[model samples]
Target: MAETRSTTAPRVVRREPTLTGELLAEFAGTAILILFGVGVVAQVVAGQNGDDDSIHWAWGLGVTFGVYVAGRTSGAHLNPAVTVALAVFKGFAWRKVLPYSVAQLLGAFVAALIVRWVYADAIATVDPRTTFDSQGIFSTLPGAGVSIGTAFLDQVVGTALLVFLIFAVTELRATPPAANLAPFIIGLIVVAIGFAWGSNAGYAINPARDLGPRLASFLTGYSTAMREPGGQFYFWVPIVAPLIGGVLGGGLYRVLVERHLPDQTDAEQPTGRIPAEDD
Candidate 1:
């Protein structure tokens, strides 16, 4: 019998991702995120528009900066679902993935809490005669006769579209756009969803962007309109739907493009928030 040996290259030792440190980075990033979303509510409610379209513009710009800054450092996920999706696709580590998600959600919740304190008075003015359903503040509403299923469909469909768009731009684009402009591009994506589908679902694309504030609003004791007439039972769509859509989108990228990437598991050299720049 002849002895045969196989030749394979050894895996390289890379620097650890520093999950704890990433949490700190994510927390700071999420603070800015909530500040924008919650701040917009306060601004709009407090009449900061001042005869101009201040609220939407302010939020758009705010989100752009936050994503850019955090993305430059911590990958700017800020949302658990996004993190989870990336991890599932192996863009991030499985070991730190769960902790990262926990940190992201906690960060958003804490940010929401602070925003509640900051925007207390403004939220208080949303008519004490009505309950303040925080989720609806960022989305559209269903009429009295609309079924619960219909409302859920709105969230599901809107979130699916959002995840699909994000995947298209981030993964499948033939050419990666300018690094500095990626966040701006993401902001524009949200804006488009908000405008196109917003009329139906208010387009709650990001889960952290919604659940964080909703929990904070309830905990802060400023809401009077918590239970609207739209059968507000299916709030999970915003959280779950996007994740589902993101996975599908990532799979689409892998099948259509990543398979052809120089290194399917890791192609682009991540620039901290950017994907690995080292091949």
Candidate 2:
């Protein structure tokens, strides 16, 4: 008699999406943004291979790709400023703000560490002393002859433009780009800010974008990472200014643009402020 043999296939289990998954998306998205943004700066400063335009384009593309990566999960708020703005105006759940910001910060920090690791030889060769100039590659710094007040104002304006444009393009009532095209347009907005506002304080415009890598540089022996060459405490400018700017921009868009637009009909109503997270 032939022996009976039975084989059971393994059961596959799928877990439902949760806040943790969203947070991981935020983390990875921000890390991707920093990886390209900082990598270009490193190439320019340490490797001596590129120029300002190269840095701008790389950072823009970084944002574009980062959004594409995390847009489906967390709406791709790769910047703390963006996260705060959404929480303030878009009903993004205030409880998630701190978590999202922390995830972004950690992502930037880890990406900066990785950038340093990858370009260790080049960075060491070019910036052996870890001076303020070298530190700028990791984080933003005031440009020559830029006052602290001017830097603050510059960040405010830059980030305001960022969040305002974000609202403009994402608002269902406004003339928004196609869903597939919004990320590229957002990236272009960053590039435009870099071109116009970068000279004052490197156009940080994003708190996590500045502070996370700044902390990394501090740990990696950049003594002036948290301060200016003149010994002024400069870190707060990027952080505080962007937060203020984000709210201002979002509010401005709501007041000046969104309110003026015709309300959506029932069939065309927007489900959420950001379409990416609606799913």
Candidate 3:
């Protein structure tokens, strides 16, 4: 018999990706994350769903819950922006980023599904009819008057400040409380950022936080609102800026300050606040 080579390409089996414990962490983190996040915005801005007055403070509690739930597992990048920054700045493994992101997005979608189910009647009753952009809806809007370049720069600088602070308080491993204190401290920082700079571009700071919710909102059937036409939405900024800021922040810390990494014992639960005084 004459030797005949097959014309078709050789079949190389692509090994299927398997779900692991890390995936669960990502899912759990993203779910509780959107719950606290969107749940807060829904309570305030959604008319019957959002009260505007009391919902704001309840928003704080939501932040606290989000961190407690997601902190240990997957470090809760709930936002894509944070995930990018984590890899670049904190030395989080690159291999994990895509999986974490997919998990985060899926988690957000599931969480949104749950919220929609809970507020089905509320969602239908609203006069104007809004898709649940609750998480990104009230939080940030794009800069109306600025040029695209300026707007982009603003997001980068603003998000960097936010992420940098995170690195300082958390990555510096300032003390035993730094890890446990993650939720409260992060929530407070967000509160301040919203008050000061959130007006333009929503102070998203974390891409996963906003983008995941935004994606869920769009997928679940909110119109062009989340899309933010003409880059007026500035979604790209939130995604890009934070990564830049996070790296800058990390670099600054490495150069300016000496690292005094906290021990494993620091993660243990404690009785009182770790003194804020810097050593």
Candidate 4:
């Protein structure tokens, strides 16, 4: 037989996405989140019609759609506080933290600009006595008589509840939602927090959510945006408090819930008999 050689092509392996792609998704998702979130606030403030319940649902649905937009690529960590929480407790890469946070902030800032432009006519018509009067549409304002310390505590507690419930709902060992309903459940959590926790200082559980738009307001003629009515510089509270709260909340979940849950694989294994505890 004549000598014959067979040619075989080398296997090609697919590569993962670059950090830039993930950052883009994070930016886009957060921008969409802020667009809807701030749009609702503009409607309520400038339109003078929407109630707090409407605000809650607007933010909830904003988060739901934002997650659906970015969950596959960036895990929809549209909040810097959320990104930090996942990094510290959920094995996310520490190297990507700053980039992710920056992307989120940029997204919020851009979204605020868009919202401001879209509502420019309404804003001009509703042009209140002062720029400070309209500032709440873009950022949180501490309620009358609410001290900075109290506001900070509210953020901490609210964020703790938010992050803890997130850890619980997303835990594989725990009874996580099936049928890809996690995003909707997460949105409901935001709604619940808004209903129960948004009285004192506008339930800003995410740093970037507050800071980025606040900066936009400050630049857009709200000179007092960074300060409270009581002459206190209130801009830092939402940022700092949520970061601390996120760490605390994630740690609490890891300690209380995750550590105590039965391993999923071990629990699912066939044993041919019920455990003594069940008996």
Candidate 1 per-residue lDDT over residues 66-151, each given as its tens digit: 77767745677776666766777745766666676666667677877776667566555664432534334432345446565555
lDDT value, residue 68 of candidate 3: 71
lDDT of 2 at 140: 90
**Cα lDDT computed for each candidate against the true fold:** 0.59, 0.89, 0.60, 0.84
In model 4, residue pairs whose N, Cα or C atoms come closer than 3 Å (at least 3 residues apart or on different chains), thus clashing, are none
TM-score of candidate 2 on Cα atoms, chains taken together: 0.91
The TM-score of candidate 3 is: 0.70
| Candidate 4 per-residue C-alpha lDDT over 38-108 given as tens digits, one digit per residue, 9 for 90 to 100 | 99999998888798899999999998888888776677889888888888888788888899999999999
Least accurate stretch of 10 residues (summed lDDT) in model 2?
Answer: 270-279
Q: Write the per-residue lDDT of candidate 3 for residues 1-279, one digit (tens) a residue.
A: 999988998899965324465567667766775676566666445544554333434544555666577655446556565666667656677787787777777777677667656655555556245633443442345656656566567677666676666666564344424557777877676666666665566556666666666665566656654555453455566677766766666566656652544444755634443212111
True lDDT of residue 46, candidate 4 = 87
Clashes of each: 17, 0, 11, 0
RMSD in order of candidates = 9.2, 4.9, 12.9, 6.7
Which candidate should be chosen as best, given lDDT against the real structure? 2
Error of 4 at 276 (Å): 35
Off by over 4 Å in 3: 1-19, 48-60, 127-140, 143-150, 172-178, 229-234, 258-279
Candidate 1: worst 10 consecutive residues by lDDT?
A: 270-279
Angstrom error of the Cα, residue 271, model 2: value is 9.9
